[model samples]
Target: MNRRSLLAIAASAACLLSMGLAHAADQDTLAAIREAKTIRVALEFGRPPWGFKDDKLKMSGSDMEAAELLASDLGVKLEIVEVTGPNRIPFLQTRKADVVLSTFSITPERLKVIDFSAPYASAVQIVGAPKSLPLKSEADLKGKRVGVTRATTGDVELTKKAKDFGVEVVRFDDESTNMTALASGQVDIVIQEPATLTAVAARNPQRQLEPKFIFTQFPVGIGLRKNDPALKSYLDQWVKTHMADGKLNAIYRKYHGTDLPAEIVKPTN
Candidate 1:
């Protein structure tokens, strides 16, 4: 071969090698977890029924149970990494956690940063307040003070329509904080998932807080880094299998005292 032709071939081979390495990296997540024998699952520790630390400070909830199952399925040790609503996706993107089981909802903005498994759970954002309150619908929220966890679906949705609803939004760092605000009467109402609202009301019956109005439905899923088709596919299949076998329903019932939502169990996309 001529000198120039040999040089060109060498450059092409190097380019191809780099591309192959990049592709391999995309599939490395599952392999890395297997090799490490530890699967780090991120979850929010304050959202009860999904995930939360018990009185003993041990993590226990449906999301935590799901993480435990996933780690066991992979034959790896489970390392629970507590994350907040705002930092969950960042943890996945920074490779700080292999998977996030923090009741993460699949949305267009979130899909841009990370990929999600098939639906694992579903929750509706609702306005929760005392029965004495005049809350009947979105229109009733006018001039009311609403508390929401910052950066959550409830916060995003409420902030978007607060002007129209004529409500004041009080942002908190976590659900517990927001719930406390509502319970202590610092906020007239709280925008949060139905699970948390129910749990909060159960714990503090004196608050008289009840579901006022549903704002939107949030289909929750396990979150992972984008571009990892192998890991994403594995999680999707795992979700499908568990949903079919009723394992997910058992977990849901254990926490929520109800069957898993049918739509979440049979996720369309």
Candidate 2:
């Protein structure tokens, strides 16, 4: 072949190889899950109802059940990776987990960093304070102490409004600590999701903590890396079908001791 023709052919071949490599990289998570026969799901391991270890340290909770169902749907074994509020998205981003089944709420900030499946669940952030606190609004909380789990939706919401309301915000590592501070009067109030507040109320009846106000309602979706369109599509379809077929509600009921509310089944957006 002529030198010019040979050079052109070699360049074309290199371009093709580069495209093939890019496609292969895009499919890494899905291919690895299939080849390994396991889906590594990140779960918030100490949050009751959503995810937590039982007395025997066995994985069992609402989110765990959801992850188990997802693995079953994919015909794969389940590998639960324990992660916390702030770490789940990072785990997905770093590919340490195939997906995060933690109760990850779909927020614009989070959507920028990772993709989400169709929401499988929903929750509302609520204010928890003693009955006598008289905290009916942000204005009522002015100059009062408020506690929230660091990086949670509650924390984000409280922080966003704290400056306007003059509310002093205390951030804790987890939900338990935030609720503990509220119950012990270390903070005058706390903001948390419904499930955590319910569990805390059951344990601390003496605190007389009541839901003072609803801060925000958000849909919970599974977190995945941005490039996993195939994985995201599969999970989105699974969530929609299961939600329509009552499977999702059954799982929700098993954990929350109540039927899945119809509004929650609808998309937040």
Candidate 3:
């Protein structure tokens, strides 16, 4: 064979080996967690009532509670990593976190890049404005400034139809900062999931940002890397198992003042 032919053959063989190694790496990932007795979870502290740190510097909320339980069930200790809107997936890709338990929405486009657990909760996109600002419909946002978290479903959807939605969209790093901007009148309104934004408003009783959430609804799930297919499947079944035992409902009721529907709560386990 010529020199070029020899190099091509070697490159092809290396590519096959790399694919095999990738598979082993996934198994190795699961094995390392199972053996080490620890799992790392990502959280966006800016989203209160789902995940956040308190005055004592201890993490708390529905997501933290669920993560701790998940780790315990997996026979491991919980390791928490703080993440923001921009870094949540990067943290997973870079091996900084095993799962993203933040309020993540699962979409077909995102599924191409990341795997998702069973739908844990449904979060609807909503518009929040000062009571003084009337917003009966999305079209009312025209000529107004709407704040959203960067790269979120709310941002993607609103930005896609910014013209039809009738607003100039201003994306922010996270919800807490976005809400602050809206409350200060820097933005006319904030776009976010209704339940999450409600919890945020409740947490800050004195500082309220009135919201009229616009979209219908979408289910939220935990995010994991696409490379770890088996891990993703395991997480889906894990969530389904929790749902079967009513543990998931109990968790949501404890934090969000509501219970998941039978359709959404069924254990795929």
Candidate 4:
């Protein structure tokens, strides 16, 4: 080969090598966690059953247990970074947290911005109201004030249907505030998960909150930054192993009072 041609080929190989190294560096989240001996997990503390503080002010819930288990399995210290519904993605994107376990649902819209691990949990979004209010269907929501946590799957779904149903959506920053709006008569209805409704009902028995209708059922996944294949693969295997061993199911049942769906425990694929 001519000297000039040899030099050109060497330059191309160098460029390719640089690009590959940059990509690897960007995706080395799992390795970084291991080296650092710590993993920052983002979770919403205001959402009960999934994540919340107990009477003693200690973090307690299914998501908390899941995060602890993940850190333990990785042999890393767990650092809980509190996040609200609207900021879960931002936390991961900004490097404030390595992963998010905040009852985060896996949706196509979200998949565009960030990647997610295999399904670890599931929840159903529902329209809830006091027993005295007859909200059996979407038709009954006309002219009613519906409260929802901002940027949540329920909020997005409910917002799309709100105008058609003649409903007004009042957005709250977190689940706790949304439930408070319902209990304090600030909103006539709320779109939330069943566990959250049960929590609100317990706190205010006079409210007598009950699910009116289910909006949607979604599988929850661990949120990760895009292009982090190492972290994604580790989490996927973690979920599969836990699901098979019944550890994940036990955590779900402990909080939700029922076993995980058949599909989750025995995934089709």
Evaluated with lDDT, which candidate comes out highest? 4
**Model 4 misplaced stretches (Cα beyond 4 Å):** 1-19
- Where is model 1 poorest over a 10-residue stretch in terms of lDDT? 260-269
lDDT of 2 by residue, 164-223 (tens): 999888889887777788777798788887778877778888888788888888889998
Query: What is the RMSD, in Å, between candidate 2 and the native fold over all Cα?
Result: 2.8
lDDT of 4 by residue, 1-269 (tens): 99999999999999999999997897899999999999999999998889999999999999999999999999999999999999999999999999999999999999999999999989789989999999878788888888999999988888888899888889999888898889999986899999889878888998888988998888999999999988999999999999989999999999889999998888898
What are the RMSDs of all candidates, in order?
2.3, 2.8, 3.1, 2.3
Candidate 1 overall lDDT versus native:
0.87
Error of 1 at 97 (Å): 0.3
Which one is best on TM-score?
4
Better of 2 and 3 by lDDT: 2
- lDDT minimum window of 10 residues, candidate 4: 135-144
Clashing pairs in 1: none
**lDDT of all the models against the reference?**
0.87, 0.85, 0.79, 0.92
- TM per prediction: 0.91, 0.90, 0.87, 0.93
Predicted candidate 1 versus true structure: per-residue lDDT over 1-269, tens digit per residue: 89999999999999999999987885579888998999999999888878888889888999999899999898999998889998998888888999998889888889988899988888778888899988778888888888999989988888889999788988999888999888788886888888888888888899888998888887888999878888999999999999999998899899988887777877665
